[model samples]
Target: MARRPLVVIGSGLAGLTCAWASDPQGCILLTAGVLTDGAASMWAQGGIAAALSPDDSTALHAEDTWRAGAFAGDRAVIDRITGVAPEVVRLLVELEVPFDRAPDGSIDLALEGGHSRSRVAHAGDHSGAAVTTAMARAVRAAPHVEVREHHTVTRLLADASGAVCGVEVRRRDGSLEVIETDRVVLATGGMGGLWAHTTNPTTALGQGVALAARVGARTDDLHLVQFHPTALDVAADPMPLLTEALRGAGAKLVSDGARFVDELQPRDVVAAAVWEQLTEGRTVRLDARGINRVATRFPAVAELTAASGLDLTRDLLPVRPALHYSMGGVTVDDTGRSSVPGLWAVGEVSRTGLHGANRLASNSLLEAVVTGRAAAADAITWTGVWRGSVRPADPATVRTRTCTAAPAASRPLPLAQVRETLDSACGVLRDGPTLQAAVDCLEPHVGDDAAYVAWLIARSALAHPLSVGAHRRTDNVLPEGVSA
Candidate 1:
């Protein structure tokens, strides 16, 4: 009998990197949509963070990341991830990622909020798109890897011993198929779609967290989600993001035609300021007119703003905080292995403690590549062990219900209601009563994956009474307008 392939779920940067890295030891890559079509990686504009400049060091990068996350991250994990960042960039370069170059022919790095130095290597403004596209191209050409597009992994199939042995995927035709695999990597991205306002694709409803939690995997910091301060405030579902790199390049966050806060602060602080301004009925806009070559350097952002009738060099782009990245996820180690045997998670889906309470700007892409590569390496070793001794277990029972199927209840709340509940209770700031209310509202729909994830976030927010990083509780004493 032929051995089963390693099954990797998700087609974002981490998933693509994992599939691409698992070279001779091939794997099956699964995605709900076409590769890179709806993944958040394709929309990322800030670029990858790595300490490649002369004055910058990996130690400084680690320190900056730790400080940005409010010193709540694991120092060891921070060091480990940052230490490999430059090498990861080099690997991307080898994969033919077209990083923007300086006049000297070296990779040009840009500075972003929460970083102490110019360390972000981008390809124009669509850094994530460029990098993920390159990896996707490589994965397509890889003879060993099998790309299964439009196949959504609804549930991870675990044997009697609680080891993942296969996956139940829903094909585009609404039919289900079971693929046997000893190793499974969930790179299903973040839960940003749980919010009514988000920069993530509507499909990113935290399915990975829900799937992992159901399988007894430990999830950490579920409430510590980071909100971007400058999601373009146009009438667009799933708001367009105005990249932070604009601020790094000398844009200003202005409200009432005046700069209210430093633009280069950690995301939480800036977002809080922006939120405060919005709450006070004051307009907040990102003024990028001063940034030279704004159109040429940030073509993606320029196009996004143009579509909204806003110009980078001519208009004060209206901005507001929107659900961006999640700092919390299924708990995993350095190699991205979860508590359950044969299960691993990468990218925003797995919390490696690299971004404790908050994520440093541009660090997400770095973490994605590092953790994805690490998981791929470890999965290869584990796959060898499984093939050597492990026998195929009985065909596992697969759940027939859609992953988002709500529990049998009279008038279970719809997803729109759930999103509203979460958005109201969990924004740039939170309080006990509001969160408790949100949790109570979502409790009845636990059967639905989106509601379940929303419940987790609300419950976690309510449990942590103190303000820390992005999980800010307004009840906690905070600076004047920020807590307001």
Candidate 2:
């Protein structure tokens, strides 16, 4: 029997978890950039959501997740993920992940927005970093996994019968290669980089969603983009995130010399409040003085503030709302299976309805672990019954086309124009006229870089007339009927 190959795309928690669970003897892992580059998994400061506390049950965690998702979440998926979270955390611990522990040697937990209890297991303020680094180390040591850096997947290849077979990749050197495989898993991160101001790496340009869409996969809830309420507004272009855990630790948000607002509000509400402050010509600041004594509790936050030339003890760190996560992407089933046969998606790349209209704090990473592992198990079962060899196609013979590709002589729209248009029309506040204008402006450059991203965001935003979660439309005020 010929050896079957499993191809996993992206190097974040979801991709890494799938690779680890698949246990494929000789698997090929494709990443668009370096392991640490452009991955939202590394930028995450909040801890993972799990039922680690004796007071916290999986039912409570699931309920919280469902509530935070605006009741649009799939209940079965929520239950499945929350149920496995504790075990997933334990597995990470056994892998040598140094999660912060209590004095009694139990896992330390913290609270964040939308949660009823302190059920977040963290590693200081760098939980995502700690888990990502640890997982990457394990992946590197695994003899069966082959990590391919700087390989961009341009398209997913499906057979004439509409079954996924492999992918066409554009290498770092601008050369193309086709890798044949029996199964493919997309773990690519979110579409935050498409926005002007975001905490995600610039490389997260909705490539995964676009690629999946190109292959005729069903996508869902594309308008739901989460905005972090407190990204440090400094010289940083993409912006630096100040974790919500700071609020959990008692930090407050206030305008210049004014009273502070409640710090425990939902991210969408808090982000909108911060945006309103900015629109009113008032700079927002995160007051850390009250929580300065516990600054040692969050070493990463303290170190980042100090590195940015601000002393938590004396100076207030400037903050603003920035695009953070996407609650939509290629649609997947309960087991992370996409509509396309032989293909699965996990993590931020797949819109499994687990997040619905809004994502709960820290649940993004939890979904990645749970769905990645489930996808791997499902893929193994799928490949067992489906036996077919995929032959590589000649690079020159296969069409080298792009959704944005135009005639060689035609001048393409500039990226700067697209960015400015999105910033002005499709940003924090939206009206029907402005959104329509945005669609009109983006229609001309449909296949262009900025236009493609703007198209997805604008179209999706337009589809959901009611305001929900991070997406807000001034013209279409959400009806009272739509309750959270």
Candidate 3:
């Protein structure tokens, strides 16, 4: 019998990079929308963080990642991810990504929050788009890689022994189709959309978590959600993001025309400060006047501000903290190996411990590409030779568990209701009562993916009593020496 090919779902940087890196003979790329459309990867602005500058070193990059994560990141994992970053940058450049260059013709690097060195490579402010577009073009032209768009993987198919065997996808026509495969790579992005005020695309519904969880795969750190401190404060539903690079370019965070909070602290600190200001009824704005050619440098942010009748370079653009990145998800090992034998995960959907509790700015895109290649290189050789069932492994915490049952087929409640509960119970700030109330509100939606993910986040938030990283609990106070 002929061996089945590998199935990679949710084409963002992780999925696309995996496709390009995997043995073309064994890879099939599936995206929820047309290629490059639904992915949050393309919307990324800051750029990939790497230690390519003579003034920078991989040790320093790893140290920054760990410090930004509140020391919760795995030291070995941090070293591994940061170590390969320079090579990843070289790969992207070879793929024809138009990285901004300095006057001497070397890659231009920018300094973002939590970094001691100016080492983030970019193409203006749209680095993610520039990188992914080049990779997408390569995928389209590759003879061995099959690119299939307009297909959403709704569920993973497992055998009686709990080993993944295939995937059930929902086509654009609202029909279901199953493709059998021994290897399934999920690159389904993050859960920022679960909150009302988020910088992620609304389509990022945390499907990978629910899908992986339903099949006895353990998840880690579901509650550790990052809040970008500078989303455009407009009436938009999924708020537009004001990239961290703006602050790197010397934009200041101000309240009532006075500078408040260091503009380059880790995201959690800045977000909490912004939240405190909001509670005190103060307006927070990002003043980008010092940066020369701000509009020319950040065309995307410029366009978004112009749409709101504000000039990014001249106006004090009103800003607020919004859900940004998830530092937790389906747990995986160095090579993107989930506990389930036939299933793998990468990108924001996989908790590789590189981000720990809070991700370093621009490190997410770097993690995406590094983990993507690792998953592909390992998953390429699968021949469905599993002789034993794989058990769910979540080692971060002893209490980690899987989703009880497959997600309910019931249609979820209104988007507004889900977002409201999440924002109330699990946004930038939280307490036991509020988190419990959120859990109670969402507990009834047994089969709803959004409600299920929301409940999971709330319960995880409630479990971590002391404030740590992005999870701040008002009801539980930590010891004086404890660092958040």
Candidate 4:
């Protein structure tokens, strides 16, 4: 019998990188929509963080990450990931990612909030799009890899041994198909869509977390979500992001025609500051007129502003805090292996403890590439050493635990209600009563994936009462040694 191909779910940065690295060993890449369309990775405007400059070092990078994350992340993991970051950038350059170059023909770096040095390697402001597009191109040309667009994975099938043996996917035509494979990697991005105002695709409803949690994968820090301070306050359903790189390039966050908060502080701090302004009924705008050649330097942000009938140079772009990234997710080790056997997770779906209470700016892309490559390498090794035969379980059995088709009584609340519940309770500032109320509201809808993940975040937030990093609880008094 032919060897079953390893299956990778989601087609974001991590998924693409994993599929690209699998190469001759091969794997099946699955995406719910067209490749790169719905991915938060493509929406990323800030670049990947790396210590490539002469003034910077991995140790400094690790320190900045730790400080930005509020010292809640694993030091060892931070060190390892930051150590490998420079090498990762080198590899991306070789992949023809077309990163912006300096006058000296060196990779152009940008300064962002929470970084001690100019370490972000970007291709204009559309760094994520460029990098993801390059990787997608590589995956398409790989002879060994099979690309299956619109194959939405519904369930992870585990055998009697409690090991993932296959997955059940619903094709574009609504027909279910089963692929038998011992190794499965979930790179399904973050749960930003659970909030009403998010920069993520509305479809990113935390399906990866739900799938992993149901299969007994360890999840941690589910409540620690990072909000971006400068999502353009427009009338769009999902808000358009004004990249932090703009602020780095001399843009100021102003309200009442005066600068209020430091633009280069950590995201949590800046987001809170922005939130405070909005709460006080003061309009906050990002003034980027001072940034030289704004349109040429950041074409993506220019286009986003243009669509809203605003010019980057002439307008003070209205801004507000919006749900941006998740710091908490399914727990994984250095090689991106989950606690469950034959199961691995990468990207925002997998919490590798590099971002503790909050994520450092531009670190998500770095983590995505690192974990993706690591998972691919380990998956290849596992397939080589473990040649155990496995059969696909009944597709019906797999769908039994899925969120779809739940009985009316236990069905999930509408996405609007879910968003309203979370948005009211879980913003930049959270309190005990609001969090408890959110938990109570979402408890009954645990059968639904969105509700389940939202419940997890609310529960986690309520359980952690301290004001640490992004999971700030306004009702709690900080302990003697703890930083608020």
Q: Which scores higher on lDDT, 1 or 2?
A: 1
For 1-484, candidate 1 gives per-residue lDDT tens digits of 7667888999999999899889788899999989986789988898999999999999999999999999999999999999999999999999999999999999999999999999999998888889999999998999978999999988887789877878889999999999988889999999999899999998889999888876667777889999999999999879999998899999999999999999999999999999999999999988999988889888888899899888888999999999999999888887888877788899999888999898999999898898888989889877433321212211211112344334552344688998899899998889989998998787767766787788878987887888999988979754445664
Counting clashing residue pairs in each candidate, in order, gives 0, 1, 1, 0
- lDDT tens digits, residue span 1-484, model 3: 7778888887789888888888656588889899977788999999999999998999999999999999999899999999999999999999999999999999999999999999999998889999989988888887778888999888888899878889888999999999998789999999888889999999888988888877768787899999999999999978989999999989999998888799899999999999899899999999998889999999999998999899887899899999999999988888898877788899999999998889999998888899888889888865656432234544322211233233332556677899889988888888988888887777656367777777777878877888788888888766568876
Report the C-alpha lDDT of model 2 over 1-484, residue by residue, as the tens digit: 8756888999999998888787765468899888756788987888899998888899999998888777888898889888998999998998888899999999999889888899889998889989988888888888878899999888788888767878999999999999987689999888777777878887787878767666666667777888888999887767888999888878889898674567777687788888898899998999878885756887787788888998877788899988888888877877787776777889999988778667889999888888888888887767434332222222221122353334531354676676666666666777778777887777656554346656767877776787776678888755558764
TM-score: which is higher, 2 or 3? 3
If scored against the real structure, what TM-score would every candidate get?
0.93, 0.91, 0.94, 0.93
Better candidate number, 2 or 4, judged by lDDT: 4
Candidate 1 ranges with C-alpha deviation above 4 Å: 383-412, 477-484
lDDT for 434 in candidate 4 is 93
| Count of backbone collisions in candidate 3 | 1
- Candidate number with greatest lDDT: 4
Residue pair clashes in candidate 1: none
Candidate 2 lDDT: 0.79
Best by the TM-score measure: 3
lDDT of 4 by residue, 136-239 (tens): 99889999789999999988888887778899999999999999998999999999999999999998899998888777777788889999999999998699
Q: Which pairs of residues have clashing backbones in candidate 3?
A: 408-447
